[model samples]
Target: MRDKLLMAYRSIRERRTRSILTVLGIAVGIAAIVSLMSVGYGMEEAITGELTGYADFIGVFPAKITGTTYVELGSFTDRDLKDVQRIGGIKEFSAMTFDSAEVEYRNKRVPIFFISGDTKELESMYVEPVGLKEGRWLRENDYKGCVIGDRVANDYFDEVVHVNDKLIINGEKFIVVGVFEKASTLYASDIDPYIFLTLRATKEALQTDEINYIMVRVYDIEEAEEIAEEIKEAINDNHGLDDFANAMTMGSMIEMMGDVFNIIRGVLVGIAAIALVVASIGIMNTMLMSVMERTHEIGVMKAIGAKSSDVLSLFLLESSMVSLVGGVVGCVLGAVAAKVISLGAGTALGIEFGAVVKPEVLLGGMVVAMVVGVLAGFYPARKASRMSPVEAVRHE
Candidate 1:
């Protein structure tokens, strides 16, 4: 057995260039699988982490009608808010209005998502989780005060904004009462670049009574789904339209995100599998060429009492060795590629996340390469084993 293994290694070494190229074919496929799948894993981790922070929370939003033309049906009314408040298992909720406005700070103007909500409720529901980086949360009576996100305070302007800095929103002046800490997750939300105002201030500034959405925090996470359904039903009932409002619990949101990531991973893996299929063909061709080149050597061995099974084992082992080596190289390249991609993407998108390469991914890559090699080499190995010794040795 040792001699057979040594002979196989020597044969591969004898054709170093061909072996290297064959190994590289398998490497490319495995690299693609590892790099692409690592991104999926990283994204899933980021999303799940963000969602977990809101596990006991539910968001109720007005549904949009999708068809030939997109239409926002309507916003939640004060009556809708009252109906939702009456639902059981509710700990507390906050009604929020959202709009886009140009904010001017030190004469530098930038477009921003303007949000107004019940200040105290907003603090408990959203701000407390990530916490405030500076100053304090908006007070109920501090109608002229607002809290800014990390990006808005630090990144959106030439001069860094500080607490007590004044911002002009649609010609209305508001003082920055607080700034939120920079969030680590990839999921973007009001915590990043948006400005938060008290509900009364927004209503007075915008001259609107419309509530864009309501965020509810349930007492028990176990009853969150049930309470979310009730909230949706109450809103729908108030609006006199079935399914007019959608209530999404954090758990449901996470599950939906998981399904989306799963589909994306499947599509990416399928594309990578195409490269493996091409690599398998390369392996088969390489094995066939190796068998033809070694025909006389195989015949000499058979004449010297080497069994057909020994010849078959030698060819198969050579192919497997090539694939296994490729898999190792591919895993290393893939991990580095994934890290580079993750950094580049994070810089481009302004989110922080790292590529997640699990042990299974590495093991699976090696196993896949070995399986492809064995299957591809089978025919060529069998043909070499079945050759007539005299005929093979007599050939040129």
Candidate 2:
């Protein structure tokens, strides 16, 4: 084996240009797979962590299907909320209204997400989990008070807002009671750029009682999914519409996200696999050319008592060595590429997540390259080994 490897090494070194190009072909394919898959894994991790944080919580939204498209049809009514609240296993629930409105502070106006709910219920159900950065949660009667997210307080306005700061929401004045800590995930409920108000205040400011959704917390998380289904049925029945509303638990959301990620990852990997297939073809062409060029050498070896098996092994080793080297280089390039992609995407999306390249991924890459090498070299090695030594020597 040692002698065979040294001979193969010398052969590759002799044709440095062709060997290097073939190796690069394999490397590029591996790098693409590694980088894309790593980013997918990282995103999956971030979203899964965020969803798990609300594992016992369920969100009920008023929605309907209109000609194959799901849309937010109408606001949840008080009757719908009453029916949902009567469902078994619900520990607590809160109705929230969402709106997009302009907030003015220090003579500057900014469009912001304006959310309103029962202050105390909202704090225990949503705010406390992410925690407050400063001040206190709004009281149920603090109709003129609000809590701001980290981004809204510091990043939105030219002036940094603080607790006790007065802001104008839809022309109505309200004081900042608290600021929430910055959220780490990149989901819709990030809370880092939101402003929360009491239900009464929002109704007064907007002149409407439009509850967008209801959030429910289950006493037993293990039964949350079942309770969510019951809540959905109850709400739909109360409204006399089959598709009036939908309820989903956090755990179910996570599972749906996982399924989506898996499909995306598979598609990306499949595209990358095309490159690997092309690389394998390149390997086969290179090995076949080597066999033709070294015909006389092969003949001489056979004349000197070398078995057909010996010739086969030598060619196989040469191909495997080239592929193994490519795999090593590919792994390095892949890791660097993954990091660059992660950083670039994080910057563009305004969210932080790292590339997740596991040891298993590197090992799998190497093994795949080896298998491709062996398969690509097989035919050429066989052709070279089965040659008639006398005919081969006499021809060239």
Candidate 3:
């Protein structure tokens, strides 16, 4: 076996150019599969982590009312909150209203998405306090102060708005109590380009009592699905219609994201596999050429009482070795490619893209490459083993 491997290695070294090109072809395919699949798995974990960070959290939104646009649809009411509070397994609930306004700072004005809610309740729902770029979050009793998003404080104004700077919004002056550090997430949420104010303050400014949405935290995350259903039914029953409101749980959102990625990964892997098929054909062609070139060598081995199986194994080993080396190189290239992609995307979009390569994915890629090599070399190896010693010796 050692002698056969050495002979195989020597043959590859003899035809260095052809061997290198063929290995590169296989490497391209394996690299595509590895990088794409790694990014897919990494995205799944990143998104799921963000969603579950606010454990057992559910968002309740006003549903389609059939005859009105989404903007004109009925908003969450005080009664809905009362009903949801009565539901079992719910730990706490908070009412929030979302609005957009042109915020004016001295000579500059910028539009911002703002949330009006209980400061204490918002704090409880979040994993941690809004990391401040400047000052601090809203105190429970504060009514005229607001915390600004990172963009609002840093980029939105003509000058950087500092802590204690007063901003005018909707003809109302609000002191900048804090500034969010920066927004980073795959999905757009209240974190980016948003301002937070006390519920009473916004309610007074808007001159309306309607709530835009509600967030509920459940005691047990495992029972979130059932709790969500109960909340939805309760709201619908109170309004006397199924389409009046919609409830979404963290688990369902995560599962939906998982399903979407699974489809994407499947399609990307299929495309990569096509490249592998092309590489497999290249391997077969190379093996056939090698068999023809070494016809006399094969004949001599057979004449010296070497079995056909021995000849076949030698050829198979050579092809498999080529693919194995390609697989290793491909993995390195794939990891570097994944990292480059992640960095570029994160810088451009401000979303975290962690490229994760699992142990199974690495092992699976190499194993698949070896299997393809063995199959590609089979016919050529068989033909070489079956050549007649007399004919092969007489031929040029």
What are the TM-scores, per candidate, against the unseen true structure?
0.89, 0.87, 0.87
Listed per candidate, the RMSD to the true structure in angstroms reads: 2.8, 3.1, 3.5
Error of 1 at 75 (Å): 1.3
Q: Give the winner by TM-score: 1 or 3.
A: 1
lDDT, model 3, position 315:
92
Model 2 agreement with the true structure over 340-381: per-residue lDDT tens digits: 998998887667788899788888888988998999999999
Which 10-residue window of candidate 1 scores lowest in summed lDDT? 63-72
lDDT of each: 0.86, 0.86, 0.82
What TM-score does structure 3 among the candidates reach?
A: 0.87
Q: Write candidate 1's Cα lDDT for 351-381 as tens digits.
A: 7888999889989988999999899989999
lDDT of 3 by residue, 1-396 (tens): 788889899999999999999999889988888888888887787778777787678988876523233543577777888989999998888888887888999968777888878787766543153366778888866778998887788778789888999999878888998877775676533475788888888878656557868888999999988888888888888888876777878787787778888998999899989999999999999999999988888888888887889899999999999999988887877777777777786777777778888878888889878988999989899998888887776656
Point out where model 3 deviates above 4 Å. Answer: 64-73, 106-108, 125-130, 184-190, 299-308, 347-353, 383-395
Clashing pairs in 3: none
Tell me the spans in candidate 1 whose CA falls farther than 4 Å from its real position.
65-71, 106-109, 129-134, 154-160, 188-190
**TM-score of structure candidate 2:** 0.87
- lDDT value for model 3: 0.82
